[model samples]
Target: MKKAAIIGGGVIGGGWAARFLLNGWNVSVFDPDPEAERKIGEVLANARAALPALSDIPMPPEGELSFAQSLTEAVEGSDYIQESVSERLELKHRVFAQIQQSCPDTLIGSSTSGFKPSQLQEGAANPAMIFVAHPFNPVYLLPLAEVVPSAASDPEAIERAKEILREIGMFPLHVRKEIDAHIADRFLEAVWREALWLVKDGVATTEEIDEAIRMGFGLRWGQMGLFETYRVAGGEAGMKHFMAQFGPCLSWPWTKLMDVPEFNDELVDLIAGQSDAQSGHHTIRELERIRDGNLIGFLRALKERNWGAGKVLREHDERRRVAFHAAPASGAPLVMAEMQVLPGWIDYNGHMTESRYLFAASETSDAFLRLIGADMDYVAGGFSYYTAETHILHLGEAKLGHRLTGTLQVLAADDKRLHVFIRIQRGAEVVASVEQMLLHVDMQAGKTCPAASSVLDRLMPIAAAHAALPRPDGAGRAVGQRKS
Candidate 1:
């Protein structure tokens, strides 16, 4: 297992820890704060409830998480290190010094939103390994990580860093040139300044400003982003037309873009008072959960269309699926799919819904079919396995957040027919079992036909191996039959 060291355990640090841990990387966190463990634990809880829902395939088994007593202890033998300490440059430089003392060559990433890569590299023993990997809040859910490397940085190391970020389900935006606050935050600082000015001028309340964004342009920005959204706004004329129409507004003083509001207590009280009235009912953790859920919904919608960040998610799932199948099969029944009972998979009584059990079985069988070369590509070629009959028996209960595994045992196989038994289990106890009979069919002819030799070559061996094992107890059970 790959190991990562997190230098701080604040919100962003905890988030980075959760992201790495969930992606199957062992993480060591070193934070001087007394409550860091509790805080990070809470963050991990929220991540457990939220992150798996965004994935269709099962996530890798969570990696080992450890709290280190010292910075050197955390960085030792770590494959990656992320520093999310206070934004003070001296503090960051000191942290880097301490980190280099232990793991001098490990890629060190600073979660500094405003500092340029060059600024971070100053006074470093090895500057090239230290780059900015600024991530948004709730890092486990948000995929964007701005990777800013300076001219002195090693190009190969930066590429490796981006690959590591991608392996953990992040979109590493390589900012070719490092600037203050990187890319996203620069736009954010502009909007933030405008919002502060609006509040200071008494033009809009906090709630109204939030509504304007979330109800309007915020939704647009979530998917298409600024340029693409405006390009669409340009209609047939495109971005050039958009510039011709709205470009003149750049000169017009419609609002204050370059003005600084007084940083007095009065302005602070005004913004704080309105924000309290807006959403102060929920605690910070509660607000985080709400934000995460909303993001998941928006992202899932995009995923269904395979557009925007959803494409990233889909690609991540496909990568995991490929890795999951690449393992060599053994003589035992194949472990086909690993899944978690997501929030949507539960019903009123808190048990996994009936449909999901079948869905789980399908996930298992589909994987097995893919293993035997009957995947979507093969189906597109006008020949595929079609389930002729299925008998399901629910033996136990699976609840929300429960991890389930789908294992398949092939009972019989021929050129045109396959008989199999699948068990969906929560660890050792089987919660459900499905027995299916499938026939190879030619899609154009819509009739049963022999499977390809390539597929049969893969299937028959597994079938023969499984045939040597004892038949499952419920292999041929009839529906509603009395226990005998």
Candidate 2:
């Protein structure tokens, strides 16, 4: 197992810990604050509830998490180290000094929002190993990580750093030239400055400003981003028309980009009071859950379309799927799919709904079909397996966030027909089981047909292997049948 050292346990550090741990990296955290454990525990709880829902395939087994007493203990022998201490340059340098004392060659990533890579590498024993890996808030959910490297930094180490970030499901934006506040934050600061001016001038309340973004351009930005959204606004003429139409407005007095509101008490109270009036009823954690739920919905919609950040999520799922299927089939039932009970999968009774149980079974069976070369490519060639009948038994409850394993056992198989038993399990317990009969069909003819040789060649062996196993009790049972 790979090891990661998190040299802080505040919000970002805890998020880093959660992301690495969920991706199956053993993480050791070092934070001097007394409440770090409690704080990180809460973050982990929230991460556990949200992260798995973003994935269609099962996640890797969670890695072990440990809290180290000293920074040296945490960094020792770690493959990667992320420092998320307070945004004080001196404190970061101190932390870096201590970290290098133990593992000088290990890559040390700083969660600094404003510091350039050169700034971070100052006074370092091994400057090449240190770089800016700034992540947005809720590092476990958002995928973007600004990976800034200086001229002094090693190219090989930077590339390796990016791969590590990708392994934990992050999109590493390599900033070729480092600048103050990096990329996303600079845009955010502009919007924030304008938002502050709006409130100060009594133009809009906090709730109104939030509604403007969440209900308007925020949606566009989430999908197509800034330039593409404007390109669409350009219509047939594209970016040229867009610039010709709005280029002169750059000199207009619409935004106070170069100006700043005085950071005085009155301004703080105005924003804080409006924010409190807007959302003070819910705690911070409650707000985080609400935000995460909304993000999941938006991201899942994008994933369905394979656009924007959703594309990153889909690619990560595909990577995991490849790894999950890498092992050769054992003699037992093939574990075809791994999934989690997402928030939407549950009903009012707080258990996984009936339709989702079938969905899970379909996911499992679809995986098995793909294993036998009857995937989308095969279907696109005017042939595919169509489910003819299905029977599902609800053996137990699967609640939200429960990890599920879908296993398939071939009961029978022939050129044109397949009979299979599938189990949806939560750990060792079978929460549900599905028995299905499928027929291979030629799509153009609308009639059952024999499967292609390539598919049957793979399927027949698995069928022969499973034929020796005892028949599942749930198989061949009619509805309302008594247990025998």
The true-versus-predicted C-alpha distance at residue 249 of model 1, in Å, is: 2.0
Count backbone clashes in candidate 1.
0
Candidate 2 structure quality by residue, lDDT tens digits, 1-484: 9999999899999999999999999999999899999999999998988888788766788999999999888888899999999999999999998888889899999999999989988999999999999998789999999999999999999999999999999999999999999999999999999999999999999999999999999989999999999999999999999999999999899999889999999999999999999999999999998888888888889988999889999889878777755555456898887777878899999999999999999989987887787987899999999999999998999998797889999999999999999999998999999999999999999999999999998888889999889999789999999857
lDDT of 2 at 431: 91
lDDT by candidate, in order shown: 0.91, 0.92
lDDT at residue 432 of model 1 (Cα atoms)? 95
How far residue 28's Cα lies from its native spot in candidate 1, in Å, is 0.9
Clashing residue pairs found in predicted model 2: 58-338
Per-candidate RMSD, Å: 2.2, 2.0
Candidate 2: stretches off by over 4 Å: 340-343, 346-351, 399-403, 449-469
Q: lDDT for model 2, on a 0 to 1 scale?
A: 0.92
- Output the number of the TM-score-best candidate: 2
Stretch of 10 with least lDDT, candidate 1: 322-331
Q: Model 1: clashing residue pairs?
A: none
Q: After superposition, how far is residue 314 of candidate 1 from its true place, in Å?
A: 2.1
